[model samples]
Target: MSFHTPSDMKLICGNRNYSSWSLRAWLTLRKAGIDPELIVLPMDTPEFEERIAGYSPTRRVPVLWMGEEYVWDSLAIAETVSERYADSRLWPADSRLRALGRAMAAEMHSGFAALREELPMNCRARQRRLTCSDNAQSDVQRVSELWQTARQQSGSSTWLLGDFSIADAMFAPVAVRFNAYALDLPVPAQAYVAHWLADADLQEWMSLANKEAWIIEHEEVGE
Candidate 1:
């Protein structure tokens, strides 16, 4: 029943093609050059519940197993990694920029409900010309505004922060979602998404996602 491994570090998540939260944690760890052994579970299966129940109290994916210790939420996993590797600048080194990144990350973690609900992450899909609600459009604009403001406030960088911080990880899934749904983003947000998609590690994750066989019924939207 234990997703726990003898290895000190492991990441337990669901199918890469459909799990946005899992992608967040996985991308963060990969960005930090920490390749934790990944345990992927098939969604909508009793086996998934039985296995993940051991690592997660919330009965969810993206649980980080640090040997006997485990971290359950994606944000918590990012924070744990950041704290463990402070010198790695998981958060920006500049205090002001760090605060701003945290704020953005927190917003990504909790807000954008409409955008998320409307455009669920589907890595294999090449959907285009999809209809979106006003609320979803507003959510997209808010994300664009946040990215534009973060870039303006921090000057120039590929990531939201001046460097690749946890903030980038927080928004990585959004980039994938936008790309998957063919959502047109504003200039700043478009550039941000482009930069992340070009990342080698992210490309690798997407490659793996494309190879997965199991499909979640809910994630197979719009045919």
Candidate 2:
């Protein structure tokens, strides 16, 4: 088997309905004015298992291929895009705010395992019911706290850090999870969720997700 590198940037992702990490990287790229060649491989499929190895050493979705170079992780992809497209202002101009945003994004990347597992991202689903574990609830609260902190620190009511930075991209999937499950949240957090839901790019992603036919049962939680 042979792999051919594209002359332009390409992103290999999993299903839009279930792949939160894919959403993060894809949204980051879009925010940076990059419309890469998209390759969607439905999760838990033979095609994904067979083809992923060629694109990613970790065998994961959301691998970004920039010619021969590949970024296999979502946060790394965001960082790379920010560096390469500095004019895009993926990070804020203020050094303090940028540091805060990086910390928040990193937390979202490395933490929140329980919230992630219990409230799997199902973009096409809404008002679903699920009894979350204590850890999951705690994770949700922490996310809310992070958002509130970002808003308070940046003095921005719209997006975290006063603009749509990589931090917002990182937390975009969490907004989906909150909306899908109708999770009870504080007023500020709920407002942030509403803001994210109204985003055109997120709406487009969900529209595509709703049209997809592949269904991974294990991720089909909540009724």
Candidate 3:
């Protein structure tokens, strides 16, 4: 079925320079063909936390408001929209493929702490790839392995499961992190990153993020 015109949805997000989780949720909604209003909060501002209390139960960004439903957390938002709009094909159709997709997205939601903390998404800056702490390196290796395994198993598909799914949306911010930090990936993973970087929507996001006047000092990754 055609999704409720995404144009009607509203997505609340934090600063584009800092909120990777928010990016994940926003991209999922957009790819689902939902034209949600992008609500951005200045992470450094005192009102940031205060403002979120009304819309976000967790007091974080990337909150999804669909009609009366309030979805918090990036992964939850994606799943909610996908299930609500079956035609979006947010997950694969085959049972096993769908299961793998969920597994990947779950892994992303709960794991990869080192990479997330060390290389947080900073859309306004590009830094040379340099020393990664053991923890961060381990996370990077694991992500590359995930992508490799998924590509090999999926065969003809360009994404984790032959087509764009929640798995890709979950990893999308990570992909941006890799690019922003100039982290080189394994050859196959490098190719995947290339695909992600070339996407027009991502490019547009980067452009807007760079143009935004707000700056959150806490999220700045490098000098």
TM-score for each candidate, following the candidate numbering: 0.93, 0.95, 0.92
Better of 2 and 3 by lDDT: 2
Candidate 3 regions off by >4 Å?
1-8
Tell me which of candidates 1 and 3 scores higher on TM-score.
1
Q: Pick the candidate with the highest TM-score.
A: 2
Note each model's CA RMSD in angstroms: 3.8, 4.3, 2.3
- Please write out the lDDT profile of model 1 over residues 18-79, one tens digit for every residue: 89899999877776667889999998899998998788889999999887888899999988
Model 2: CA > 4 A from native: 1-7
lDDT of 2 by residue, 179-214 (tens): 999688999999999999999889989999999999
| Model number with the top lDDT | 2
lDDT of 3 by residue, 19-69 (tens): 888888877777776667888887867888788888877888888887787
Per-candidate local distance difference test = 0.84, 0.91, 0.81
How many residue pairs of model 2 clash at the backbone?
A: 0
The local lDDT score (0 to 100) that residue 219 gets in candidate 2 is: 90
Ranking by TM-score: 2, 1, 3
The CA lDDT at 73 in model 1 is: 92
